[model samples]
Target: MMLLIKNAEVYAPEYVGRKDVLVCGEKIECIADEIDRLPVACHILNGKGLKLVPGLIDQHVHVTGGGGEGGFHTRTPELQLSELISSGITTVVGLLGTDGTTRSVENLYAKTAALNEEGVTAYMLTGAYGYPSPTITGAADKDVIFIESVLGMKLAISDHRSPHVTIEELIQIASKIRVAGMLSRKPGILVLHMGDARSGLTPVIEAIERSSVPIRTFRPTHVNRNADLLEAGYEFVGKGGYIDFTCGMEGQPSPGECIVEARRRGLAKELMTVSSDGHGSWSNYAQDGTLLEIGVSKVDSMLQELQKMVKELSVPLEEALLYFTSNVAEAMDIGNRKGHIREGADADMILLDADLNLDTVIAKGQVMMEDKRIKKFGTYEHSK
Candidate 1:
């Protein structure tokens, strides 16, 4: 159906004036001062007094399901389509974490394909929480180079549970990623799963200096989980590297505070991103290495973080929106299609009421939620 959204106080993450957006099928056909005239038989949405931002792109999500660190019983179930849609997330890049054995790359790949079939955009990373990452082709480079959905490999760095890879090992992995990305024209980012190990990002910086891998290739996440990690993240951002702060992991410093502090410290704004880490376990480690406690992931944390940035931190709406949308899109090299509201772009958008409540969620021109109610859900979500 052709749809026209009229008089939206649009913030394509920027204050574009009062404009109308016309969507044809799954793509935006026009975004201008006025659509001139609406097509016959088209649905019209009066967006008066509403803010329109690009639908969020969460780069580091366990969409297939994460958490098996505590045990099989503690394993979090896979995320449902509505959980993401209701949270204003339109595109997601799924990754495997500590449960690579039970949750294979094949399953992650299949889940991504399934989400696409269900009308939500999804992509994935290869490898998991181990050295010598498991891949469908038995090689990380081959997977990223050949598979369209495979963007790069993930490394568990500076965490006690990690493989404790040396700079040489990290460099070698990044080398393969570089070559593969060069051949495939993909951004072969090394998505690092960081923890509160306290070793800091020194090793990562050294690895970049010693190898051909650019600083932008090393994407470290979980920066807001701790004070020192946050400081290290700012340093990385200053050095032209990107940092990802995960929402829903509590008991550390305030994530909102860290983001505000980063801005105050004059860090590059475009290099920052926020992800949900949804469905992943947040296991706390005691001083002696015992698992103290854990928590289930929440899909709403992405918006929670965004709200914190805008409300508590007094961050402008435009800059706040970029953390969850455009920054991630640029980091993953999906800038053309995802993470922005533009003509000829995917019609993925979120309409927020004046109170910042998610009122409408549109993924690929299909309304998944309206008036705080979900209109669509995943295949197994409602199964008895």
Candidate 2:
């Protein structure tokens, strides 16, 4: 598979000037100012007026279904590949959320495999919201080491859905995940789901205070759910931890506010990331625990936030993109292959128009989307 992309205003997430990229098979073979000649079989893309960048990677996505909270009718449908391709996402991390009983780790793993086999790169965490979280091999630690795609585990902290773990339990679980990561030579960090509670980060703080585990082991997501949670979450980020914000919700802080606030506080830019939480259920409840409303998150929201950060917020292109591409790839410990555009890196890229709309998407040297038309879909995709 030889592909030649010509006259691309390239930003390998760092503003590399106009260059031509050559993709050989699944890897980038060469990148230069000009490629005078290529084999007749090579596919060429005229990238004039288009900026080519590393493909966007969504770190938190529910590829399989995620809800069951309200009852049997509320379980979300599995994510579709059309949603990802049109949004410029070539790599995604899938996880199980809320319904560990009805939805098993097997289903999540199967979906992950299906997505990867279809087109994009898909990875997943092992456990879910409960204590002694569900695992394929019956042990979370062993699953992380033996499973090729199981990189870490996810747990809900300070949420009504969580197991309400003690400090000791937190320490034990974190320790196990960290050890599994070490054994597997992968990033075994815990992905924490934060809720709308008064004790925002109390459990995380207590765990850090009581144990010697590295602070980076915890990744508290949905920090931007509320102003108070963002405020408290920033403290953890200050101390060498990471936080993820969910995008596309109304009544929450805009992209400008969050990025500007992070700059003002001088937080670690690399530790910050944003996710769509796509295909998961977003619920609103009354004080009495009755479900009032339910809405599903969209994958397009991640692309929307990326556009907002660059165009509306006046953030530098490179700086604004780190939260979606390279920064996220590094956090997941797959930076070597997934993130940047380099000689030996994976051939996953996206071309954008002046307005930042996705013009084309290529994953693993295969063209999946072009000119706003989707060219690829999963195995069981419906034509209608």
Which model scores highest in lDDT? 2
Model 2 over residues 292-370: C-alpha lDDT tens digits? 9987888998889889988888898888888899989999999999879888999999999999999999999998988
Quote the positional error of residue 357 for candidate 2 in Å. 0.6
Q: What are the TM-scores, per candidate, against the unseen true structure?
A: 0.97, 0.98
User: How does candidate 2 fare on TM-score?
Assistant: 0.98
Which residue pairs of candidate 2 clash? Answer: none
lDDT of 1 by residue, 344-372 (tens): 88999998888677888889998888777
Q: Candidate 1: list runs displaced more than 4 Å.
A: none
- Model 1, global lDDT: 0.86
